[model samples]
Target chain A: MNKILSTVVLMALVVVGCVRQDESVIRIGAAGPMTGDQSKMGIDLRNGVELAVSEWNEKGGVLGKKIQLVPGDDQADPKQAVSIANKFINQKVAAVVGHWNSNCSINASTYYHTANIVAISPASTNPRLTQQGYKTIFRVCGTDDQQGGVAAEFVLKTLKPKRLAIVHDNTTYGKGLADFFKQVIENKVQVVYYDGIQTKDPDYKAVLTLIKEKKPDVYFFGGVYPEAGRLVRQAKEVGMAIPMVTGDGVYDPTFISIAGNAAEGTYVTFGKDPSGLPTSKAFNEKYTAKFGAPGPYSVYAYDAANIILTAMQKTGTTEGTAVAAYITKNSFPGAFGDISFDKNGDVTKAPYVVWKVTDGKFVEMK
Target chain B: MFTQQLINGLALGAVYALIALGYTMVYGILQLINFAHGEVYMLGAYLGIIVLGVLTYWGLTAYSLVLSLLVTVIVSMAFCAAYGAVIERVAYRPLRNAATLTPLISAVGMSIVLQNFVMLAQGKEYKNMPPKLPTEGFNLLGANVSPVQIFILTASILMMVALQLFVAKTRLGKAMRATSQDRVMAGLVGININQVISTTFMIGSSLAAVAGVMVTLYYGVVHFSMGYSAGLKAFTAAVLGGIGSIPGAMLGGFMLGLIENFGASYLSSAYKDAFAFLVLIITLILRPSGLFGQKAMDKV
Candidate 1:
């Protein structure tokens, strides 16, 4: 009787193990911060990927096999992202669409590269990500250099402040972007104050107080929305009244909500606002119908998903090597516009536009 | 410029002092560095935010900001005090006579558990308090000092004074002092050592809660993980002040705040956190007993 029970348990284990990877479906992984501070962005990315996959599956699937999206929640953490990458590798996913934060993508891509699994990030923009020269890594968004350069040009050509201050959260993304911005503006503009702040620091009075002494006309904060909002609010409290500029990290409406009245007149550098774009019309309509409204990265996530699916279709296989090769050779017409990759697997023409927050909305400035 | 930076340093130091007192007090009593003490402060800030958020949602913020802050402080203090007592009863009490490493491990475990618990309950995002406080400030020597800074400084001093009086003037305080000197002897001399220890944890945690609330308001945001950095700095302050000395902890906290703010202002902002640790290293090298700490002679 014990031998019979053991045989039954072994069969059960086999059945459970085989359930995830069925022969009829091709698995692709979607990893992001499904729950946490960045859950909205993660959920938006997952929705976009799922929507793209479902649309493809409805149209007779990709390469005569149903596309299945395996979702993993990395919680926007670097360590968790690496674990998720390992999980995707174990599941034998052909490609992964993920890692909204740059540091997560930078860390997780190392594992994906080792496993030869193609990873296309939707939102990470740290310059070092592409500079690492990994064949398995690709991003559909602009790097900090591109975004920060555009911001610096806009500041120098348009706003043209005599003195400027650069502040960052001291993380890889924040500091990297600030450094990029500084590199462009340092020669033209009189750079007065530059500082790095703790990410979760509640107060910015000390830093703002020092900036007040410097009295910079333009203050660029190279951090995400939460910290940027605090800086704006606290800067106003300290009576600094300077115009603040930031990267695409503050494109969300949450920044305005957090900073309230202080968010007005603040400038943010975004790659492109896909909502009003002619190409994104149908995608935006369908996205709003399903998920109320697409987030800042939803179109990028959709484009990322589409680019991977397109590569798979062109190559006629779910194999990572063939798909990545196809991706490198071909250009994708996406919601953001024509997306092409250079030798570094970075988008060749990652155009950036500046937008100023006017009455709680990002209005593009020409 | 100098005056502005000095005021900034003092304001930052005041919050650090409140948190350091908790570490110093617990260390004074048990000699067990309660690593979980930081989480208590983090939870206190969360409670303050939650209470304020609920009150604001109910349209009570229009009633009065001062009243709302008072309610937040009281509620946060009560909840944190109970939590401190319970943590002592459960995590620390069980391993009372165990190996030294055992309770330390338990404390670390407790810290992680508390952090995750709060993270699960309140989503792991930076919760921002609306711009409720009056942003107006008075100018002193060309430096703007906000009412919030004045309040933080005043309240911290008041609490420190109250704690000093409680420790030095009351019978419970005497019992606490005696228990810390020798727990077994204090127990034989009709002092409830366990009760003294619980009271010590409660007081320490309550002070930390007040600091947590002040920091939440001062920074205008709070996150579940905020405790780790604040706790680390406060612990450093406690050690800098003389780990087991209350006054030493207060001085250490101020010194750390001043060093960090001044270092960030004068030297480089990237090394703001490093300045505190640098001073701590230098102080330990030169005077191992800390600035205000008495030299601890080998008892045996």
Candidate 2:
């Protein structure tokens, strides 16, 4: 009797394992520079996917099975990103959620294409990302063109400054945004003092000095917050505060810490609206309850994750091709708003909100 | 603009000098370049920011800055000193007689471990440093002189002077210098080589703590990975001046900083790091022994 019971238990265990192995649950791989200089973006991006996947699994995951999210860190290097992509493909993941930067994503895109897998990016905004119009490439966030148009419109109408000076850090994202914003707003405003600063440099006093010489009515920075913060604080110290404006890239709490009081009058353009959106109220409450502090990018990240899950639900399949097709063909409501992708898999809903650094916080400007 | 760049480079070079001291000192004695030196700098900054953040959160506004700075130095130095000594005994001591690359690999591993440890303790977000030495500027020589910059330079100088005195006047200082000159000879002369090595590591790590604190005060922010960039720059400074010479290390750091600032201001700001390394390459090709290092007769 004891031997019989043992065999029965063994059979039950084997059946359970076999059932688990048969369907091959929705396994998604995410990669980013989670352990290097530009790691914050990867960490933030993973947090979005993690929060979404965990929630999906708890709610009886896609196709009636658990979802597994495999994370690989690229450490922000282009070479590392490609290697990570090959690893993800080897694992036969249903989809991939990474390569945060354009360089990394661009390198990994070919690998994902070859593997017959769809790669969704939450952050990489270079226009060249989906220019090939690959069936598998999708981006949840607006591209530099969308963001630049919004910024140009804001600079043209809201601020209405007579002259505009653009400074970029010369990265793919930075230079792209600067060039697009310059082209759009150059006719509307007097363009002066166009320049590029390096990211690793600790000082920008000369650039600030040149801007002072040009004395544009407004200075628009197309770079990350690290350099922007230095420029902002130094500009204030040297008394060149002509209402410095920046893009969505520098719209984080780090800027406030870096620039201090000088950041108070600064403005940045981003797609997400905080405290102004009626639809995001529920998300804001849940997010604040879970995370102690509320960073600006959480909403977009959550939206990206939720939209991915919603796409999976729509197709009723974890197959990358089917899901990607469904995602581009339909619209879905996410924490940010309704997300609908264009033919090139870019988010069609383009809305830019202006935020002012009021009292060391990103307060809604309009 | 030149004056501002010069001053900025000087200030930045001073910070690198303090860190390079640790790298230079450890390399001088053990010939083991502690890869975790950057992590020590990072840990020090994090400790300062965390302590001050807690103080501010607890509403201890009056003495927050002074108290946090004092505590940050003590705690960070204590932790890093222990880390350095233990790392030497466990990671390096086993491979003491092994090929040089073995110890270098161990040091690199130690760096990875420390970075990951710091990441887990402090989330990946950038922490805001407490307000210290207010962001007020005084115009001097047509450059907007930050009183804050003045404080940074003065404080860094005092720390270096104090460090120099510690090495020159203290009992352990002579032993360390003796060991660096010739470890086996010092051991034969009735001095404990291990003790001297431990002492050197302790001193280098302690200096890194001071650098970490000052940098946070300067940047008004700290990140877990802040040490990597600063550490690379400082290591370059150490090599640029002279790998084993203290004064050379200091000179290298200041020179690197000046090059970076001048390059950023006059040349391309985006290529500042490239410019710094270009200078190093030029220097290495021209003077392999560094600015102050003496060229020795070839054994051949």
Candidate 3:
């Protein structure tokens, strides 16, 4: 009877301690694919969140409380993303900055909406993500319609190929982007070949051989780096010397390294190059010093976290609905430039630009 | 187009054959499907990357590409052989006398363990292999045949031939055959069962390692999860051919590759993987013992 009484007292004390500790810190959630093919990008986004939280803590934090970041790995799967969303809700995170993949963002946003938690995806660009009427859902990146339209315009105006071949990896992001591209170029250009390849299969020679026979003037791939790298390399091996174009998914240093010489002269569409701006200089230096180089979505994730933090500071509360309302009403200056969400929770201005791989680096094409 | 697709199939089949040989050899001896065989192949590719990275760092690749490649392949094969032996001893040896299903489960557990181990050690990103060979090759008939494809085909064939000769001629080979035929009788006849089993794993792992190296070189990329799909296909090949027959494995590998490529070329690329499994299902229904497997009868 004495031992049981003491054990019950100890459990009570531990629970109280946890509740007390949770009260003094504002918890922000960061979630993405931390242990799969897209992990590098996920880690980059997480690091951006960490940097923002640390900077806030050093400056006495928001609402006179220290900031804490809770990281969750969704592995780029929709089902895993829903579970991660539930975990974040259970943890009582004020806001979430993550879910790089479009499908994951779309799936998890419903749970976040029900829990009244704000989710600001830094990389997911599918337009339907914002069109679902979830007031709590937001993103800092350009939507796929804008990005794909820019890529199509560039291909039609600059390359002006007579025949085009479009391929996708059949994921939500890839297929969505490819569909947007196809919509723009549907009647303008003759789509000699269009198909979806299984991602991570690592053998695209057979498919590339089939595409080669079609004799398309240019090729466009709608996928992330892992598949795009191999597809481009295999395309070169199959004697297809035509130029290849893709969207923001292929914007990474890993893609260049994977494709080697085949990466040269390839075209990629992403948000305007902010690294050349003066506002981004300090962030770039600090990020590069800590984690080699910022990935494609690093700055966007940093800006997303900062937006949440600033909104909380301005509202003087960590409540999700209030912070989200503040974000929609105003603009926040960031490393990427002025960021303000429209009524649909997308960035007001979609600044998509064409970048060419030149001499082993992504150089903005005029 | 037909000729070109055939060449692609052949190149792909060569790697599958090399990996299938490992699966078949281990199953022949222990009658336990070594599901971890694919992880061994993945490790071989990583080992190749490490060795090749070192060679390139030392600038030896610039001095002589041939010598550098030879060293990389040999070192990777040697490391994978030792790794295979260790896995067999640790994961399989204790379960040898247990229920058959027990060893198979252990094989799966080992596969997951090795995959996670590599993921934690090397990271989740794909590692880029520095290209040491020229991508240029001559046009064959109507298809473009790269030098790397030729090397993969030639090297795989040479290794298969060498493995056949080793199994047929060596004294150790005869001991392996005896043990596979009847373990108790072979043990009574003074054949070291444990040593023969270890040797079988070593040889099989070395062949898988060779396949790993070839794949990394050909694709110019390597990832930890690569072994899963490759292993599944290779295991399918081993079963399609008689599981215990060496030549049958080679034939199965090439046939599966051709089926996949031609299916992708003619019918649809989306159903390429389905084609290989379709053939496997049909073959199983027609011949339950597999294409080359002999029907066994229990002795009363």
Would candidate 2 be rated incorrect, acceptable, medium or high by CAPRI criteria? acceptable
Q: Say which candidate scores most in DockQ.
A: 3
Clashing residue pairs for model 2: A198-B269, A198-B270
In candidate 3, what are the lDDT values of residues A1-366, reduced to their tens digit? 999999999999989866765777889999999887888888999999988888899999999988999999999899999999999897888899989999999999999999999899999999999999888889999999999899999999999999999999888999999999999997999999988888778899898999999999998999899899998888887888998999999999899988988999999999888888988888888888887788888888899999999999999987778988999999999876788889889999878999999999999998
Clashes of 3: 0
What DockQ does each candidate score versus the true complex, computed on alpha carbons?
A: 0.37, 0.46, 0.58
How well is each residue in A159-240 modelled by candidate 2, as lDDT tens digits?
8988778899887778888998998998878997787887755456656765776779998888777778878876865568
Identify the superior model by lDDT, candidate 2 or candidate 3. 3
* Reference-based TM-score of each model: 0.90, 0.86, 0.93
TM match of model 3 to true structure: 0.93
Weakest ten-residue segment in model 3 chain B by summed lDDT: B291-300
RMSD to true structure for each model, in Å: 3.9, 6.0, 3.6
Q: Report fnat in order of the candidates.
A: 0.48, 0.42, 0.54
Q: What C-alpha lDDT values do all the predictions have?
A: 0.87, 0.78, 0.90
Off by over 4 Å in 3: A1-21, B53-68, B120-123, B295-300
Collision count for each candidate, in order:
2, 2, 0
Q: After superposition, how far is residue A317 of candidate 3 from its true place, in Å?
A: 3.7
